[model samples]
Target: MTEALGTRTITAAVLVIGDEILSGRTKDKNVGHIAERLTEIGVDLREVRVVPDVEEEIVAALNGLRHRYTYVFTTGGIGPTHDDITADSVAKAFGVSIDVDPRARAMLLEYIAEKDLNEARLRMARIPAGADLIVNEVSKAPGFKIGNVIVMAGVPRIMHAMLEAVLPTLDTGPKMLSETILANAKEGDIAGPLREIAERFPGVSIGSYPFLSETGPNTNLVVRSRDPELLAKAAREVADMVAARQPAA
Candidate 1:
């Protein structure tokens, strides 16, 4: 059944929320991970927003991104901490009631004795009604799915685990194909012709990843496309373009 459906282009947006992120107390790594993962799963990451813990900002960002993209994944602010407000903001965005879900409560109950599961811990159980849970094996506080949005934890390890638990349930498109050519050059020197090739192959995405080392300047030109043939075609053009600019050696 899955094979019958060929690869389809999908666009996605990510929302990273937390005061710590905004204040520069913690640097966010999830955005980079999600972008790569989406690309691997045949989804294009069109937009990313890092918002503070404020509810109004989160709700607005959520409503806008969910409407604009195929899927919206939010990381952070879903933990037991006092500042964890992603769930509440998402509930407001969907105009739903925030309450302790029976399923989530049950899951919490499994790990903690009833006497020990106090209101503070129950905070983790409060999910928007009618949303599916994303399992967190590292810490049993499950993430929730409301509409097209999947809200997960901020901690990298738990967030990755939750993603693993939920990713299988999602309908993924065709994997994107990529070809890379490494050359001894700087990005500025190659940016112009690369842009032209990118324009020529409108169906494919051409990106230049640059690095500096004792070996001298280097750049990896990456060509990505859903079509393998198109990716190869673009890659060849990029290599030719780079070679034309390379000094005699």
Candidate 2:
């Protein structure tokens, strides 16, 4: 097992594949959830790409993301439907064979009667060779892990459950520490200066989250870093910046 290096950065990318998402039939919530979860476990979400269910597109996206990031997660397109070609595309990307895994078959067998586990349902079991199974607790159908890519369900509930099952097995680096300062400023007003602070704190990730309410305009400046001291220092600087911009009462 490879241990995560100390102070070494780990990053991940998400590939959301489905015609449904691209057509606006379904909104993608997995990317945000996965990003938060990965950040909690010390992996930075570097990029996200939403692609249609085209095989060539899926193959190209997966190949690119898998090589660029420590982990690549793909949600949507692993189902038994006709448009579900994620498995085949992933296999092609790795130059591997797509086959039914006996382990996955056994797990499915536990839920459904032997006679009922027919061809279509068995389609879910067609995992890429040498891939590890990511257990699906809600349904017996399993997600798969090939190399550094994890193929999970499209349904947010199921995808979240599958991630819970898989996260423990991954090597996580030092969890990020974050500090926030809320200021009565618009995002547009602070975006430029905040970006400068972010550049200054090279090790920290600075984000400006703006919210509107009856209370007035508010922006939360969050600074995240693997080093607690660095995060605190950056947070103070951001607070000062925001305070300076606030109109004196």
What's the lDDT for all of these models? 0.86, 0.87
* TM-score against truth, every candidate: 0.90, 0.89
Candidate 2 per-residue lDDT over residues 47-103, each given as its tens digit: 999999999999999988999989999999888778889999999999999988899
- For model 2, the superposed segments whose C-alpha errors exceed 4 Å read 1-6, 187-200, 241-249
- Spell out the clash pairs found in candidate 1: none
- Cα displacement (angstroms), candidate 1, residue 12, comes to 1.4
* Top TM-score prediction, candidate number: 1
List clash counts for every candidate, in order. 0, 0
Query: How good is model 2 by TM-score?
Result: 0.89
